[model samples]
Target: MENRPKVGIGVIIIKGNKILLGKRKNTHGEGSWCYPGGHLEFGESWEECSRREVWEEVGIQIKNLRFGTITNDIFENEHKHYITISMISDYESGEVKLMEPDKFDKWEWFEWDKLPSPLFLPTINQLKEGFNPF
Candidate 1:
């Protein structure tokens, strides 16, 4: 098939001293915890993608977005690679809704250091690079 890195956008919505995350299912990083995000559509700006993904994944709104970090995630087993761009934002409003029940089932907030185990590749890579979404 194709052999190029896809641009993925990840949003770290901040609420109090916690960040939002979900347990992925039926995807490359299945069973791993990850932030709300997805592929960046063509013609979409980084900020646009961040906000869209967050709302699409979980019925919530975010604001005060700031550039966070990026990670070159290569899922060797899945034969997929993504240039994951992370964005940090403050939780503006709304409740967490499992909008995509097939993709994710559980969504919650957690302290960065107390994050759930078995995080997705992009998340692990970001952490390794000393990403501090504070």
Candidate 2:
């Protein structure tokens, strides 16, 4: 068993009245809806990780980046722990494209109150804490 928790970054890309999320296809949170994000790379700041992950996963650039919230998620079934920093950003440029088909099915915009079920742990926590990026 790992003794340390992993660090991750989640990006909340707000457009109009909707937020961007993706249906996870593979890995730990498979079959859940989540925001565009990934593991925080070594030597990378949380903001940098947010930008890179968002661009890598969904092929979009984000601006007006700001700290949203943080969640300590423990996936008991998957035996993984993560300290996720949620970052808020507005959609700036680039079209919404699935840059990682193997990792996610597709990306879509959804209203906060009507988000899809089985949300990722981090996202679930964020919502439960009333972390609204709008």
In terms of lDDT, the best-performing candidate is 1
Model 1 residue runs over 4 Å out of place are none
**Alpha carbon lDDT of residue 91, candidate 2?**
92
Model 1 over residues 61-102: C-alpha lDDT tens digits?
899998999899999999998999999999999999999999
Report each candidate's C-alpha RMSD, comma-separated, in the order given.
Answer: 0.7, 1.1
Candidate 2 residue pairs in clash (backbone atoms < 3 Å): none
The ten-residue window of minimal lDDT in model 1 covers: 125-134
Q: How close is candidate 1 to the true structure, as a TM-score?
A: 0.97
Clashes of each: 0, 0
- Tens-digit lDDT track for model 2 on 75-114? 9999889999999999999999989999999899999889
> Clashes in model 1: which pairs?
none
TM-score, candidate number 2: 0.96
Highest TM-score scorer: 1
